[model samples]
Target chain A: MIVGERKPLEEIIESLEGAEKVLVAGCGTCVAICMAGGEKEVGMLASELKMAAKLRDMKIEVSEATAQRQCDKEYLDTLKDDVKGKDVVISMACGIGVQYMALNYEPMRVVPAVNTDFLGANLDVGEWAEYCQSCGDCVLADTGGVCPIARCSKSLLNGPCGGSADGKCEIDPETECAWQLIYDRMKALGRLEKLTEIRPPRSWKTSRDGGPRRLVREDQKA
Target chain B: MKSGSNLEKVFEKGEFALTGECGPPRGADLEVVKEKAKHLVGYVDAVNVTDNQTSIVRMSSIGASKVLIDMGLEPVMQMVCRDRNRIAMQSDIFGAYALGIRNMLCLSGDHQIFGNQQDAKNVFDIDSIQLINVVHTMREEGKILGGDDIDGKPEMFIGAAANPFGDPFDFRPIRLAKKVAAGVDFIQTQCIYNMPKFREYMKRVVDMGLHEKCHIMAGITPLKSLPMAKYMAKKVSGIDVPQEILDRMKGVEKKKRAAEGIKLAIEQIQEVKDIEGVDGVHLMAIEWEKKVPEIVEGAGLHPRPQVS
Candidate 1:
């Protein structure tokens, strides 16, 4: 799921500088799962901003709201009353959510209260590691179901670079080396030959290098 | 000669080829490059021009290679995936090949935080192996990696870096085999201060018979002083310096330690030269370019073949 963390209290407070009314909106989907900019986070941010405003002796009204998913226009449109005439609307969701709020409600400044990180899985409590690069092209089958694009520090397709040490990336020992995991996974599956297969250069068309991508589904568009 | 470059010719004739490294100046100072080239000429078969080594911004490797080419020295331009994307890298490879540069050493560049610039974005679009395959595919098939044909391609002898002492030690030779499968013609390993470990690595290479497929040049850096040895042992990753080596350096007097370091390096050069799978030695006399002639001559690798 999309991962993100809330912006610092100081930065959120500063963005609402001289603001009379502020709306803090959260998403109940991906961001919530990652424990980032979810409904609870929205309330925490709103309360912290209110406390800061009081300490600074500023006149501000902090309100909190949450949508089932902020990336959807329908979910965002339902929050019209909560965001109506608010001096600034702070999104406690991912970047996609912030953009959706701005698209529906214009001229009212929309700011992000969280820094969007990556699409990944939660390994353990308070631990998240990226698992997908959204490279558009997937090589999981050839790589024992591992995503090299997001795991390998260099995005090496063929195999690991010389930096794999103790099954961790040379850049940081804490980060697991993606290729090591791929090799071990392949070995366990008795498909080690899959690792020996040389991979050609990935195409940019399916990657972010191609530019901002948009997908349209004719079958689902009904 | 596959590349028709002097380095490839040396490797082809089965001579213990010697290569040196000449880092381009951080600014536009071609004179510094020429001076370094002067120190390496006649003593080494090729010179590796580092590309923003350690991630600090420097003169582009292609530009530095051009200077070396004009100075009658073969420039092995070192390329890394840290700075450029695929489009930019391919364009630069073609540009370098078009201008008489024929050799390259692909590397996964150091993280930017190690250098002066900590805020720079790292673009590892493809690792060194993928990079080698790109150039190799272009040369063999006369096509881009995406299967598009081009009028010309980089008919260059490609090389990559190896680290035998790095962790998951069992995976080093396997990684080299993968590089060869990706179409690497030659390899220069990370600096070697640990001989037993490197010999063990080469034995594996021989066991896998990778030496028959590609040339492997052992990397040697003559320690300048005891402090330098300590720094390399502690600060540098993937470099294994055994306790005996450090003790040997300590055994020498302060004034004579530099010469002792050189002697140890010459010993390494002589030993690795006999290692069955090892092809040659790459002398990275970093910041000590002037001493290259001495080391090469002392190691009996002087008078690089003048074969055209």
Candidate 2:
């Protein structure tokens, strides 16, 4: 399940401080499972905004809608009818979902109600953390499922950096050295010899160096 | 807004307080409710008109508040987010303020499934924390929920609920601290029964330094019967009366339970009053308003010292 937290209510209220009618749009995919931007949350947000407006003696109309999966255009299309005539839409989806809503609804304004923190799974109820950066590269097979690209604060691939001391990352005392985790995993799997092969310098071009990349499959397109 | 001029302010200002709750009419013939408001006028500082309290529908909170205000009793309009969207919530809040309903309680509201409106859609557009923050933002910063600066802000005496006896105990104080940080001026705790447990919880809150930041009013609900006590213990999520108290209730006869309940509630008030960091007590008679004055008097809590 995707783990995330709703942005502070004050910030959300500030984001939509003016104009009358507002639609609170929720995503039912990862954000739903995380209990951040789901149908339930959408209703709650709408109710709170309504009550707040009432306290201020100002007339602000709040409506709520939820998309099946905000990142998917098919699911986002569900909101087309709901967004019509609404002054502003507060999106409770991930960053991707927010962009998708903006792309689909050109004239309507879309605002994020949650901070897209990171790609992490819930270790337990109400706990979440960063796991992957999705840097358009894969090196986990040699590193025993630990990605130095994400785990190493510096994204180092080969061995541990000078910051690695006593098997922990110096930059963050809470973090274990990524290479240390790699060494232990490889040793347990009897694949320590894999570490002996020094990897060639990775090409930065295919990564973020190439701004905003896309891929298409001709066979699938037909 | 208007700084919540109801009876609650008297309590805040070191005056005796009188408070009551509106049981919203079961069916819409509001005469019974109006009479109930009339009965409370001589007694309470403010009457809290509940908004779809317990998720059971009745006359709208705005209407009830207006009735209470007209009846010569200050009304603390209890507004919940169970039924409206931000638009309606905002309008109703201002509507109440305009009509002189100042004291407001921001709640996430009860689930529709629990009420007769099962098919009704739930619009949680916001939770208690956010709702309180919205009121706080408007009152302190002069900004509305939409981020637009208001020509004039609502002067509301903001309040929130706390359940020290609720689950995730370790997280409760932290969450309460978060509400305090968000600008809660006062808090009405879930009904407190087990005094020792409540004292322990109060100590923890004081240790966290929240006691000084906000006024804490302990909730007191007089149980009318052993069965009622059992029902509250089993049905309520945040209240957990100790086994000793429950046992004592069971030992009493059904006819004597109401009196017993009042005695126990008075005992609770007396005990809680001496506990450090406890600012006051909120007597939630739960449809037993006649018994509140008795309970207060029995506990030696004089409303007049503060009322004048």
User: Per-model C-alpha lDDT, please?
Assistant: 0.87, 0.74
lDDT of model 2, residue A79: 85
Deviation (Å) of A47 in candidate 1: 2.1
Candidate 1: the clashing residue pairs are none
Clashes of each: 0, 38
Report the lDDT tens digits of candidate 1 across residue range A152-205: 877878777666666878678788988888888888899977666667666767
DockQ of each: 0.51, 0.02
Q: Give the per-prediction TM-score of chain B.
A: 0.98, 0.92
Residue A70 lDDT (model 2): 90
Model 1 agreement with the true structure over B1-308: per-residue lDDT tens digits: 66788889998888888999998998998899888889888889999999998888899999999999998899999999888888898889899999999999988888776788888877887778889888888888988767799888779999999999875676678788889999999999999987888889888999999999999999999999999999988777667788889999999899999999999999999889888988989999999999999998898877788778
TM-score of chain A considered alone, across all candidate predictions? 0.97, 0.92
